[model samples]
Target: MTTVVGIDPSLTAAGVSTIKHPRIAGNPNKPICATMGRQGSNADTITQTAIRIGDQTRRIWGSLPSSVQLVVIESPGRPNPNAPGRFAERATVYYRIVEQLALRRIPVVTVASKTVKKWATGSGDASKAEMVAAMRELWPAALIRNDNEADALALATMGAMQLGWLEPELPCHISPNVSWPKGVVRV
Candidate 1:
């Protein structure tokens, strides 16, 4: 079984999910084999944020199974001019997490926020509640507690569809523009 991981990286509460599936032309039956996330102390000051990033990065990487085939992470939201500090910290953490995966030679891809929404709810402008509802409607067995988890799960499923690890189960958009890096073997 090939493992696929999905992550919604937030310093406060990152949502992570894993699924193991055979890369064949068929539907995945309740494929949510595992779920885990790293919760860190609040990152307030620059030093605290740096420390949190390091700790969370290591924990996130460790959370993955060794047989992982692909990782799909939800990209950070746009920088809010008012909350510039928070945005910067989040962006930094996001890149550091991605870098850690690259160092380990793992194939990682980041899906845009709207892309995830569109894939899950068939609307780029879908609300967070809408996403949660859609996920509930689609994958009833998944323990999706919040929007973060729902988004991450959607991203993983979309990535699997994109990489040909599973059949497309949703009538939504997986952007044709996503460029998988060199190590990723596209089917």
Candidate 2:
């Protein structure tokens, strides 16, 4: 039973989803539980956000079962063309999470925003509403509210698909030989 935790890191409101292998036969990728965490608005500084995200990640990671084998985080896609440095803030937060995960010796993986979106909704440019709709279709009882949580859940689902954690509707083969260190896997 492998456990995978996915994160959509942000300075203001980091989103997270934890999934476990299904206990019943014929179903392997069902998530047993899920959660989300938001940094307090009082944490006005980027440094404070990083610290908060790190602390929250540590706490959540600690509470998981010893069987947890992988942690997947969503990497910021191409920086906003119009905003220029808009992604710098999120990148810093992602870096901090990666650093902390490495220190803990847990295997970490990263999936691009486009890749996760495409995998979830069949369109890399899918809107937040579309993503949320797709997630609801996948997990009818999932109680996801905001887009951040939906994105986090999508990242987790993509990670599970990549790791062959999910039983696909169509017969498919995922290569386990591909090497992924503590960072992003370019799809």
Candidate 3:
């Protein structure tokens, strides 16, 4: 079985999910779905947050079967100007995840945050609550307790659909209203 892993990285709370492609054609099974994080007050330092994020990621990777072929992660956009310092801290956590996966030689794919949101919900600017609701409607078995988990699963689903391992619930294009040229719908 080939598995695609999705990660929604953050220092406050991160989401991890996986979709396994079975030998036979059928629904892709999401055998992993969870969030990991320690409160900022608990960590108190950026370095501590990075350590916790790395440890959590390692634990999740260790639990997986060795058949994981691709890692799909959200692209951490430019830090908010109003919260640049805080952004750096969270960005560091995201970088740690990418670095660890790269060290393991796992192929990492970055899907934009907006793209993941649109892929999961119908709108690119969907709220966190909307994302949660959409994911629940799509994958009823997934216990998406928070937006992070929903994002992870959504990114994983996008990767699987892109790889042709699973059919997409919506058009694969990031833009829902995109007017593709004739016969150029798939991305």
Candidate 4:
């Protein structure tokens, strides 16, 4: 019963799924247990958000059984060019997660957003609703309230599939390398 936790990190809210890998067929990837963590409003600021996310991560880490083995995090998507300073903030959040997970000595893997989307919906550009619908098909009883949590679960599913805990359920598709249109670094 290896436990793998997938995290969808955000400044205000982070979605976490703790899955107990099962040996069952068809539903081999099902998470025997899961939960989500919400960082309070006061922690929404950039600096505070990083700290809160770290705290939330630590809390989740502490709660896991000794059998737990890996941690998977969805790499924050590249920031919008029109939004100044957003890239830095997003990168900050991502780095914080990686750093914390490393400190815990848990093997961490970062899955790209496009890869996750493609794996879940057959299209990297699929809408949140489309991804949610696909997840429902995979886990009929999964309570997918929002895109954040759904995205987190998708990352978990991908990680589980990669680790061989789950069967190869989705078709194999190669994800194109992420690229920026033009000189858009600080934007």
> Which candidate gets the maximum TM-score versus the true structure?
1
lDDT tens per residue, model 1, 1-187: 3778888887777777776676432353454523344444444676867787777666777778887778888888899987787677678768987887888777898888887887788888999899889877877877888887887788777767776766666557445346666756547
Residue 60 C-alpha lDDT in model 3: 54
| Residue runs of model 2 more than 4 Å from their true location after superposition | 24-67, 81-86, 170-187
lDDT of 3 at 183: 27
TM-score of each: 0.83, 0.71, 0.79, 0.72
TM-score of 1: 0.83
What's the alpha carbon RMSD for model 3? 4.8
| Candidate 4 global TM-score | 0.72
lDDT, model 4: 0.64
Worst lDDT run of 10 residues, candidate 4, spans: 178-187
How many clashes does each candidate structure show, in the order listed?
0, 0, 0, 0
Pairs with steric clashes in candidate 4: none
lDDT score for residue 114 of model 2: 71
If the candidates were sorted by their TM-score against the true structure, best first, what order would they fall in? Answer: 1, 3, 4, 2
Q: What are the lDDT figures for the candidates, one per model?
A: 0.74, 0.65, 0.71, 0.64
Question: In candidate 4, what are the lDDT values of residues 1-187, reduced to their tens digit?
Answer: 3776677766555666656666432353455334446545533576766666566656555545566467667787777879645456556666866786667676777777777788788888889898778877777666767776677777766666656666656564223233312321211
Candidate with top lDDT is: 1
Per-residue lDDT over 55-103 for candidate 3, one digit per residue giving the tens place of the 0 to 100 score: 7656555645577777778877788988787677667666767787778
lDDT of 2 by residue, 1-187 (tens): 4667778776566667767655532343445334545546543576765566667656555545666567778886668877554476677667767787778687887877776677677777989898888877776666777677788777666566666656534221233223366453433
